[model samples]
Target chain A: MSEKIKFTIDGKECYAEPGQTILEAALDNGVYIPSLCYLKDVIPAGSCRICNVKVAGRFMTACTTPVAMGMEVENDIPELNELRVSIIEMLFVSGNHFCPACEKSGNCELQALAYKYTMMVPRYPYLFPEKKPDSGNKKLFIDRNRCILCKRCIRAVKDEQGRSLFAFKNRGNELAISLDHELAENISDELAEEAMEICPVGSILKKEKGFQQPIGHRKFDKQAIGSDIKSVIK
Target chain B: MSKPVVATTSLAGCFGCHMSLLDIDERILDLIELVEFNKSPIDDIKVFTKQCDIGLIEGGCCNSENVEVLRAFRKQCKILVSLGECAIMGGLPALRNGIPIKECIDEAYLNGPTVSENTEKILPNDDELPMLLDKVYPCHEVVKIDYYLPGCPPRADLIWNALIALVTGDEMELPYEVVKFD
Candidate 1:
């Protein structure tokens, strides 16, 4: 048993393990912190910055910040609320994300967060960047506009598959996530089932799986991604 | 004595769209022969008033500054092209939907543990700032878009085809691989 630390989240004092994040502690205690780029089992990459909370006196990402003793955390501060909204805005402009028409509408973290935050109207003009529609790979489509380049897919390629097919390209708002081969060779038709299982977003999915299961009909068991993504490693 | 002026501008985006343009690799020389870059991110040229044959606009209009740049390009160019998902669909940053603009700014500057006081700045002149569209929109919604090459950043072939179409004056056709979300 590791050392236990106590922290106050949303006015509730709870005990958490040493290495766990504030998000883990809160979720463990039945408190929900809305997150998009976070998936259990895989190492936490706080790129999306959606799971923000006020720690002690400052706002911090709940997913990346480790637990500390006697820390007073405010999970839903006005400022933290604002950050979540901004991060979502950034995600919206970076991709062609239309939820009502998307397959992942009901289950989409982006849409769920919008509903939670009450982002009823878009505060910015639609950019409509010139983008190429779904590329030839039918199993999944890469909408450059919708990708925040969280690198989770790139991380999935490296951590789960043991192959570095995806690379983070360029810098600033222009940065994009890309795969080396035209079609991800390692992600063969057989392995695609597993790839879809590992990918966190609509970026990589099975071609045959589209519009088959209404997002509402899908069952979310909610477990770690330990063996699922790494099935291709060997 | 006639080098067609081509302009490029980046708006509220990560600049990934311009990088995708470089994916052209060796064929860039052939492209330069047809048109010269007037206000590209690759070059230092920022301000442009001359009429450009093609205006390649990247990034979504997120801030007042971004909207000004967009309108400027639209006014000067003979053909306005939306270059990536950001320019076309408001990109990922448009996710700020439903959340208040004040709240969005709060998250970036104050609430997070990495707070920097400098992140706090007076909101731009509300009148100057382009009003937020009801939702993220494709390029055709805001301005008269002459050609649209869809992609997060459109693939190389689609981009090249767009250039070819502009120079040759052909109709813009949706490529086979392009997925239409609208």
Candidate 2:
């Protein structure tokens, strides 16, 4: 068995394997750390910066920082939460995230995080950037207006040869997540569904399957995001 | 003491938020008892008779008229609450924000396929008509918005809880189930 490293998160004693990151360790110990980019088993991108935690006076991305013995991490605190909320607000304003018209309303991780943070109104002014939705693919569509650029779909959705189906097209300010048309055409139904599931926002949606889940019955409908971990810890 | 006076308006919205307010069901009776309507569609009060304690604004500013009414509400009310997505983020009408105002006007009046009867190609620019803004703006952008309830049309329970909390001067309880974006 791998050696376990002991750490303290928000004053709670926690243990994790030597190779695990702080976020993984916290979740393993049933501690909830709100994250958007870091998917389980996938390499940590730390792009979203939503899972930032204070470690010994310096802020660190929990998903990128590895667990260490005697490490003191502040997970759930007012300061960190406020910072996270601000990031969420920035994402909301920068994107044209009209949740009422979005198909991934209740299931979207970004929307769920906004709900968890109780984001009544974003502080920043809305950009309302001009973006077009691509519905050319048979099974899936990419709505650029709602994309938060978390890069989860780009990082996770892959073909049989380990080639990425989704990739970033264009440079900064004009950056957009684009699907490889050739690869997308042959994408299986299951993969298409997974792509939709991996997206943090309502960017990637599976065609012909929307609003299938009724209100009050979808994910994050009854409980706030990461509540399961809190319940488990209790 | 006299009841708290309340006013409400729908600027660039579908009045769905008002429908949600009525969704408070028979509890609207409790609301009527708790507060008196000043300037609202419910009371048919065309103008504010007295200063209001609370102003529930349902929609964002999409035109000069919306801005004017919003400013008037801000002047008349002590607290202003942005009700629903439209009031908070400009919602569906804001979808036009990315496009140029000229293009939008042209599409609607002169060039759109739906326009079948514009042989003279005249645009509505009368002084009586409210001129559209370059883009839709959230309520907070125009004036100080004290509170915001975000939903397509904010849930009935959310509206009720907010009003009750505001009137009673108690901390608002935001249950996870009630605070949804859609």
User: Which of the numbered candidates is closest to the native, going by highest DockQ?
Assistant: 2
C-alpha local distance difference test of each model: 0.65, 0.93
User: What TM-score does candidate 2 get on C-alpha atoms?
Assistant: 0.97
* lDDT per residue as tens, model 1, B78-120: 8888887667666577666545667776676657567656554
- Model 2 RMSD vs true structure: 1.5
Candidate 2 per-residue lDDT over residues A99-214, each given as its tens digit: 99998999988889999988888889888889988998999999999998888888899998899999998999999999899988978999999999998788999999899999
Residues forming the 10-long window of minimal summed lDDT in candidate 2 chain B: B173-182
lDDT of 1: 0.65
Worst 10 residues of 1 chain B by lDDT: B173-182
Candidate 2 iRMS, in Å? 0.8
